[model samples]
Structures are given as structure tokens and as C-alpha cells.
Target: MKFGEISESEYNEFEKNHPLGIFLQTVNQYHVLNERNWDAKLVALRNDNNQIIAAAVLGSRKLHIGRLYEVTGGPVMNYNDQAVVKTFADEMAKFCRQHGGLILRWIPNLHQAKFDDHGNVLETMNQAAKNNLELAEFQYNEPQKVENGHYSKVALSYEFIKRLNGLNAATLEKSYSKDAQYSVKKAKEFGVTIRKIPYAELEEFHKYTTATAERRGFKDKPLDYYQKSFKAFKDDDKFLFAELDLKQYVILQENEVKTLADRRQQLVEKSEQHLSKHRAAQARELEDQIQHHKKRIVRANKLITRFGQKPVLAGSMFSVQPQEITYLFSFMNDEFRDFFGPYLIQDYMMKLAVERHIPQYNFYGVAGDFSGQDGVLRFKQSFIGNTYEVLGTYTRVVKPITYRFVRLLKRIIGH
Candidate 1:
């Protein structure tokens, strides 16, 4: 197996073709990391057929001790194929040895590795056993949780194939949990309107997103971040967080949705008695079927409410990808929140996903270990999608002393 660095485009292509592509391996994440995290490299491993079978997208930086090589949600490989995975690991080890105390951290693309308390992480202890490389203690933790190396990546999923099918407003309202359904109902009275702000409306998108971030104690991305992201993802409008003029459009849609859901529920209860009654074996199946019908009704109603809002709203960027729609950012006035503007906007977004065929919506990194009492996690869990735990941070230390000294200094500095 031959290993060498490749370009971002090549890795991105590989990422798309590879079934195990995680968000961090995507071109978007790579570029973001390279721009902000560290210097980067693409380690490509090819088979005799010259097919690139195993690849890792990593970022490296020179440290006082030696160097730091951190893989960003990568090392896309066939873990079942021991030879190839070993080759990849050996090469990584060589890089570490060459750099002196190499820290090769990774977030693997598959469910192959075993992690203890902190979800999937690059296990320093088991590296040798799994890939025939020597080991070190695994230190997998984030800024807030890494007291003695604790980390977690929040990734959620639903019964993807079945649950996300309510691909539009009709399906979304149908699939929502009762509280979620109630949240939908609550949004309307507040006069919330959910709609994509289009690429042209990025300024506005950043507004809501920044507000959301600041509230959560995260530094919001600069305006340029969204601008660059939009330029790169113009084709995928589904990922963008849309704006809802609460008094203008979102509330109206929610009200209309609330009305439709009520009607459908009434129909469903009435049909419950007349419909399939194979009471025991067919219970779940029948419930799903009834829910699907009601959802279709709600969707039809949302369509009717949107007709009057052509020139009524502004613009925003959108990501059309089906399974994962991440709102890069959003912003809104806290003053207007009395309308529960955010929920109104969220309801509209779920409806949009249903309508546009985007199933999985990502609210991104929710302190997976429950680091603190963050209300946002609750908000995200209230949606149609279930929470997922992503592979946590992995680093193969190139310069152990450098890390050690840094650790010492951090400790001394009261970090």
C-alpha cells in the first residue's frame, strides 16, 4: 500500500464516494479546519489496483516539543480489512515517530473502534492491538470536559429510512412528539414565519445564528465564515437555517399547521376504530400508517399558507442535501422572542424540510456529555430526529514532551 498526501478536492471526492463520510471529512469541514485549526495534509493509501482504498484527512502544526498531527473526523478505511487498516496505522505511526512523540488523533468515519465512557475516540491504549501500532493513554476530551481527558461528540440519528420520510411539513407535523406538536401549535400564536433567507440574505442569517451562539457561550463565526460557506455550498440549500418573520409568515404557517394537525388527529381517532384492528402484532405498523396519513394532510395545509409570501420575505443560503441539513448560523432579536419567534422559525424549518425532501436536520454539537445545564439540547431533542453521539477527538502525539510541557504550563496557569 502506498501512502501520500493529496489535495482537498481529492479528499472531498473520496469523502463523497466513501459511505463513511462524516461531516468533518467533508470539504466544508476540512476547509474550515485548515483555515482555523492548523496546517493540513491528506494521507492517501492506495491498493495495487491504484484505487485509493484508505485515506485520512489530517491537520498538522509544529509544536515546541515536535509536531501535532490531528485528524479531523477521518481515516476513512475498511476496518474489516485488517491488512489495509494496519498499513494505514503503521504509516501514521511512522509519521508520528518521524515527528517525535507524534500525536495522531482521529475521529474515524465508521463504527469500528471501541470507546469507553466518552463515545468513539482514538483509543491510545488499543491502537497497537487494533492496527499493530504502539500505544499511549487515550486522551479524548474537549475544552469543557477534558479534565483528565474527557470528550464527547454529539451526533444523533432517527430510524433514518422510516422516520425522516415525512420529508416536508405534512410528514414533520405528523411525526412530531406530542410536546413537539404542541411547540408547533405554540409558534403560530406568536406569529412566527419560517423561511430560508437565501444566499442573498446571509447577513440576516448570521444575525439569528450569532444571537443563538452568543447565548450558548460560543463565539459566533465572523461574517466571512458564512460568506465563504455559502459560496462553496450554493447547490445545497437545505443546510441553511431560514428566517421567519414572526408577525409576517412563520406564525401564520404554524397556525395553519396547528389547525391541520387538529383536523388530522380527529380523523385518525375516528379512523382508529374503523381501520386495521389486528390489535397485537400490527400495532406499531398501524400507528405509523395513520400518522403518515395525518402528516400528508398537514403538509397540504402548509402549502396553502405560503402562497401570499413571495415578495413578503427576504433571502438566504440553502443546503439541499437530503439527510443532513445544518443551519450554519442564524440570528434574531431577543425582543421579538415574545412571539416565541425561534420556535416559530424552527417549526417553519421542519415544514420546509418535509416539503423540500431534507430529512435529517442538525443542530450541531450539544455538549454530548451533558457538561452543563444547556436548554438547547432539550430544544434539539424536541425535533423529529433522535440524538447521535459522534466519534470524539483523537490525537497521536508527535512531540510528547511538547504536550507534556504545555500541559504543565496549562496546569500552572490554572487552566
Candidate 2:
């Protein structure tokens, strides 16, 4: 096997069919990095027959010691083949050295183990364990046992066909946790609507996202970062938001209440006329439904009076991909938590995936240590999906002293 730079077009054509293909490894991502002044390159390893065996988008930045090179998503390849992997690994190290680099940071799209819903390691890859060093010099060293630094080692993604067993909304709802299903139903009943956030309206979403980040205690990327992301995925990605029309919700609830009242009145008349046991049960059911509608009507009227006729933005979601439609990130209005905006928007995206015949809907990163009682993990699990564990990031030190110094600084700074 041999390693050398490849054309962007060539890399893309090969990546289209790569098993671990992701949007992060695409030319779009490289262009985004380029805008930030990072030097990016597309490289490939070819077999003796001259067929491409592996490819990667390498981004480089000048650091104190030298240039730091990193691969995003992966060097797309069959990680199971040790000989080829070892060869490419050796060549990458030499390539970095020749290019004045201190380290080669890589994270392959390979699984290290499989875990159960309870987070128990169900299966471990013996091959991955053995050849792990053949691919790189150092393993991921995040403080959390579950995550690789800067990336989640565990992936939680829904296998739509296998999990839901059908493409319809009913099957999708049935697959969700009862709480999630109920939330989605409530969002619909409350007149929540989902639509793409026009790029021009990104600043509006950015403000909401910043507020959400502050409330959730997570760092929010600058608005420009999202602007670049929008541009990168503009052709094939979705930046959707769930909005609520309080006035429309009130109207809808009012109509529903009226319908339930009419049904209850009819049931009351039938029961009075028949004096039958079945009519009595029917009347009881109608009364319960009417009571439920009345409560909803009250809530809707309160919201309508408070918010007027404006469409209140509830939450925003962003997703992108090649093989899978991944819900990469989201921001919700804390004030509208009861509106279930996240659930409705996520459901809408998942349904879009089903419509396009995409096999998977990735909820994306989650901690592998499930016993820790992570709220984010619990929320993602509510949607139902297979939990996957990755081997995590790898590092090849091209300049050992420089790498050690960088590591020491990172530790001192508590990174």
C-alpha cells in the first residue's frame, strides 16, 4: 500500500460509498476550515492494484513546535485489515514529519466494543484491541471513561426499519417512549409547526441558541461558526425549527372542545334513552374525553392571551449526512419546555429520513457510561436506538518532545 495526496473530486467519489462516510470528511467541511485559515488536504492510500483503499481530509494548523495535523471523521477504510492499516499508519507518520508537523491526530470510524442499553460492554473487538497500536502511537485520553477528547466515543443512532419495522408515523410513534410520544402528540395538538430556518434568519436562531447554551451551561460557538456550517450544508442539510402559533392553538383547542362537548351530549342522550350498560360505558368515555379537552382549552386560551397571534419559536435543530441523517445539534427555549418543541422537531426530521429511505437517524454523541444518570442520554434513549461504542481518537507523535510539552500545557490548563 502507498499513501499520497488525492484530488478533492477523487476523494469525494470514493467517500460516497465508504462505509463510515460522514459529512465531516467531505469537501464542504474542508472548505469551512479553509475559511478559518486552516490548510486542508485530501489524501488517499491505494492498494497494489492501484485502487483506493483509504482516504482522509487532513486539516493542518501551525502550532508552537510545528504544524498540527488532524483528520476529521476518518481516513475512510476497512479498519479490520491490519496490514493495510499498519502501512498507512507508518506512511502518515512520515508524511507528517516531512511536512513539519508535531503530531498526526486521527480517529477512525471503527467500533471498539458494543454496549447494552444499561451500558454493559456486550461485545469487544479483539482485532481492534490488537491492531490499535499498529494504527497510532497513543490512544484517546479523555477523563471520562466513555468519551474521547473532543468527541463522543459512544454513538446513539436509531435503526429506523429494524426498530420501528415500518415507515408510517403511527409506527414511528409506537417506537418512541410513551413520554416522547405523548409530547409529540401534545406539540401537534398545540399547533406546533416545523420549517427550515432560512439562512437570513439564522441570527434569530443564534440568539435563542446562545440563551439555551447559557441556561444549559454549555459553551456556545460564535454565530459565524454556524453561518459557515449553514453555508457548508446549505444544499443538503436542514436547519429546522418548531414554532407555535398560540392563537391557532387556541382555535384548535376550542374546536376540539366543541367536538367533544357534542359527542358527550349525544352519548348522554343515548344513555338516557337506552338505559343500557354499553351506553353507560360510552357515556363515561365521552365525559372523560370532554374533561381532557376542557383542560387543554384552558391552557391554550392562557397561551393565546399571553403570546397573542405571533408564532413563537420553540426550538431549532440541525442535521446533515451521507449515509445517515444525524441530528447534530439542537437548541430549545427553556420557557417553552412544556410545548415539547424538541420532540416534535426531532420527530419531523426522523420522518423525513424515513421518507427518503435513509436507514439510520443518528441522535449522535452520548456518553458510554450510562450508570451516571445523564439527562441528555436519557432524553436520547427515549427515542429508541442502538448504542454503539467507538475505539476513540488516536495520535502519532511526529515530534515527541513537542507533543509532551503540549500535553503538559494542556494538563496545567485543565483542558
Candidate 3:
């Protein structure tokens, strides 16, 4: 097989149908990177028959020591085929060298590693890493640091493969954790609704996302970042939100509480007349429900008074892809988390994907440590699906001194 730079149209046509395809490997993504000041390219490997077997979209940046070329969630190839991986790596090294680049940095979309909670390696995820290092004559040195070797990259993606043929809200509910199921039901009962917002309404999504970042003590991308993302994906992208009508919810809860109170009174009268075991149990359950509704009424009243009659934007999700939808970024107004906004938004996205005939919905980017304590992991795992531990990132050093100097510079820059 030989490697060659392919046109954007050719690469995208191949990528659109590949099972391993992702937004990161799209020509649109290259455009986004280019806007971010990175030089981008689409390269492919062809078999002896001149058919493309693997492809990648790379973005390069000039550093003080040399140019750094990075490919995110690529090259789109079969990592299980060692020969293909090596051939691609050697070709990639030459490509970088030709471009005056010192290294090829990438996190391939290959699932080769699995690990236990304590970080014990269950499978040797070394072939791709070895291929990358050997092609550039670099060593996988100690601690897996950027200075020694590229640090191990881990991301948790919740992937659902089942066709949405027989799926509906209730059936999907059965797959969720009991708490999550209960939360979904409660959110519905409390009148939380999910809606798709057009590009013009993306500012609201950004508002909630930025608020979340501030609350969580993380840096947030500028509004232009989301604007570029929307443009990158074009019509394939969606910005959705779970919203609560605070005033309406308050009224609904008030009426529900009144109805439950009446039911509790009726049950009390029945207990007074019969006092049977079933009657007493019914009375107790009615009382519990009455209390629950009353509490809900109070909560709703508080929210209404605080946020007013407008629909409260509770949480938002940004999704993109042609056949498979991936939730690229999401955030909730943490104060409204009790309304289970995030849960409702996720379920809404799944239903939307299904309605669009998209076969899969991805909850992207969870740490692969699988320690059960990771809140993100736990939340995603609650929805019964597969967790893929993709082959982590690799760096092929094309120029040794330049690579070392770049690593040192990265350290100095606190990368």
C-alpha cells in the first residue's frame, strides 16, 4: 500500500460510509482547525489495487522547535492489521518530514485497550504505539509523560448500536438505572420538556454552557468557537435544550397536590370504614404521594418566584454527524439539576436520532479508568450501552532534537 494526499471531496466520500467515521475525521473538522490557525490535510493509504484502505485528516502547527502535526480520532484504519498500521506510520513520518514537521501526533479511533478499575492493563495496547515510535525511531520512555512519551489518552464514549426499530421512551426507560428512570419520570411529571433550537438560539445554549464551566471551575471556549462548530457541521448539527415552564409547572404541581390530598382523604375514609391490610397500605402510599407532590409544589413555587414565568433553560446538548449522532458538548444549569434536565435532554437527543433514522447515539468523552467513582462514567453507564476504550494517542518523531525541544517547550507552556 502507498500513502498519498487525497482531495477533501475524495476523503469525505470515503469517510461518510466508514463504520469508524467520526466528526473529527471530517473535512468540516479540517476547516474548523484551519480557522483555528492550524494547517490541515487529508491523506489516505491505498492498496496494491489502488483502493483506499485507511485515511486521516491532519492539522499542523508550527512550534519553536518544529512543526507539530496532530490528527484527532484518526487515521481511519483497521488497527488490528499491524502491517497497515506500520505502513501508514512510516508514510506519515515521511509526510511530516516533507512538510517540515518534526512529529505526527494522533489519537486513532482504534479500540485496542481495556483496563480494570485500578488501571491494570488487561490488553496490550502497544502495537499502534510501537508502530508510531518505531517508524520515527522514538522510544516509549518512562512515566508516559509528554517529555518522555506521549501520555496515555483516555475518553469514555457511550455507544448504542441497537436500531431504533422498536424503541420508544418507555422501552428506553427500562434500560436506564433505577434512579435515572425515576428521575426521568419525575422530570416529565414536573413538566420538563426538550426542544430543538435553531442556530439563532445557540446563544442560549452557550449561556448555560458557560455558566456550567464557571461553576465547575473550567475554562470555556469563546462564543465564536460554537459559531464555527455550527458552521462546520452545517445542517447536520443540532442545539437542543431541556426547558422548564416554571409558572406552568408550579400550577401543575399545585393541582396535582390538591388531587393527591383529596385521594389521601378518600383513602383515610376507606381505612376508617374497613381497616383492612390493603386499605391501610393504600392509605400510606397515598399519604407518601401527597407529601411528594406538596414538596414538588414548593420547589416549583421557588423556581417560579426566582426565575419568573419564562421557560427556564435547564440544560443543553450539541450534537453532530450524518448517520450517527455524537453529543459533542453539553452542560446543565447546575441549579436546575434537581429537575433532571440533563437526563431529559439526553433522552430527547436519542429519540431525535431515532426519528432521523440515525442508528447510533454517542455520549462522548469519558475517562476510561472505569473506577465507578467517576461521575461522568457512572452517569453514562446508567444507560445500558457499550464503553469503548479506543487506542490512545501516539506521536511519531520525525526529527529527534526538534521533538525533544518541542516537548520541553510544551512543558514550559504548561501543556
Highest lDDT model number: 2
Q: Poorest 10 consecutive residues of model 1 by lDDT?
A: 153-162
- Over the stretch 1-415, how does candidate 2's per-residue lDDT look in tens digits? 7799988888888987886887778878877888778999888899989899988889899986689888867878777677767777778778888999997877665566666678776677646643655545655634244333223332232111123336565577788889898988988877788988788978887887788777766556688877888887676667778888776676776787788778878777766667478777877887788788678667767766775655455655555555767776678766577888888888988787777666677776665547757676677778887567655666778878878898899899898
> Whole-model Cα lDDT per candidate?
0.54, 0.72, 0.72
**Which rank order by lDDT, best down to worst?**
2, 3, 1
Regarding lDDT, does 1 or 3 come out ahead? Answer: 3
Estimated TM-score for each candidate? 0.61, 0.83, 0.81
Candidate 3 lDDT over residue span 1-415, tens digit each: 9999998888998898787788889998888888878899899999999989989998899876678888788778776676787788788889899889987776666655554434555665546555654554544322232211112332322222223456665576786779778887888987888877777877877887788777765556677778887888787677777888887887887787788778878777766677688877887887788788788778767777777765555655555565577776778766687888778877777767766667767776555545566676567666655555555556667888876776788899998
Segments in model 2 whose C-alpha atoms lie over 4 Å from true places: 129-132, 135-170, 264-298, 301-313, 401-415
State which candidate has the highest TM-score: 2
Clashing pairs in 2: none
Model 2, C-alpha of 285: deviation from truth (Å): 7.8
Q: List the residue pairs that clash in candidate 3.
A: 156-366
lDDT of 1 by residue, 213-257 (tens): 666555666777776666655565433332344234444545555
> How many clashes does each candidate structure show, in the order listed?
56, 0, 1
